[model samples]
Target: MMEEILYLGNIIFFIFLWRIILQVLLSVIQIFLKKDRSSTGDEYHRLYEESIEWMRQESRKSHRR
Candidate 1:
């Protein structure tokens, strides 16, 4: 009976350790994904600003004509 208890305890300990490892991996993946999304958003915002400026310049030229 004592041996059986020891075996069960070892199994439980291993399972707990495995869960902790998986949590750490998932956290790292989430951080990486957030960084990737922010970079893409920054690029899109810069392009939008440039297009708005171009439109304003064209409007001014049209008014001069």
Candidate 2:
């Protein structure tokens, strides 16, 4: 029947729409996670640099003595 065909077509259309929406949401989540990871990486890098500087100062003090 024509009504059944129309109902099936609508269902297919909705499925396609939902797929697109889900993809977009996943992309947004990925971007957010990447940003968070980068920020954490920067913090870790800063800590490493500070540790290196501290070690260098300790070495210099030992050499002076």
Candidate 3:
């Protein structure tokens, strides 16, 4: 029974370690894929404005009696 418990502990430790390593690797890859913000800032702002306008319209519709 003791041996089984030790083996299970080792397995869990390695699985957790593997998850941490994978997350670090994915974060590094995302950094490479991310875009520079200088060119796209205006487009992002426009989309944000449209989203806020849509939300206001929806709230106004819901508040009507």
Candidate 4:
């Protein structure tokens, strides 16, 4: 029983170590392949402007009613 427990502990340790290594590798890859910020930024700016225009139209509609 004790031997089995030790073997299980070793297996768990290896799995944990592997996960940490994999995470580090993926983070490094991500640093090199990150998306362009300017395009996303432009999309957000366009959405914001559209939202503001929609709100203004809604306000005008309410005033006319």
Models 1 onward score TM values of 0.78, 0.87, 0.52, 0.50
Model 3: per-residue Cα lDDT at residue 3:
100
Q: Least lDDT summed over 10 consecutive residues: which range in candidate 3?
A: 31-40
In model 1, residue pairs whose N, Cα or C atoms come closer than 3 Å (at least 3 residues apart or on different chains), thus clashing, are none
Residue 13 in candidate 1, Cα distance off native in Å: 1.0
What is candidate 3's lDDT per residue for 1-65, written digit by digit as tens?
Answer: 99999999999999999999999999987776565454477789999999999999999999995
Q: What are the per-residue Cα lDDT tens digits for candidate 1 across 1-65?
A: 99999999999999999999999999999999999999999999999999999999999999999
Rank by lDDT, descending? 2, 1, 4, 3
Backbone clashes in model 4: 0
Model 3 lDDT, residue 19, Cα: 100
Cα error, residue 30 of model 1, in Å, equals: 1.2
Candidate 2 deviant stretches above 4 angstroms = none
lDDT digits (tens) for residues 1-65 of candidate 4: 99999999999999999999999999987776555566677899999999999999999999999
lDDT of candidate 3 vs native? 0.89
Clashes per model (N, Cα, C within 3 A): 0, 0, 0, 0
The parts of candidate 4 lying over 4 Å away from their true place are 35-65
Best by TM-score: 2
| Superposed Cα RMSD, model 2 | 1.1
lDDT (C-alpha) at residue 23 in model 3: 100
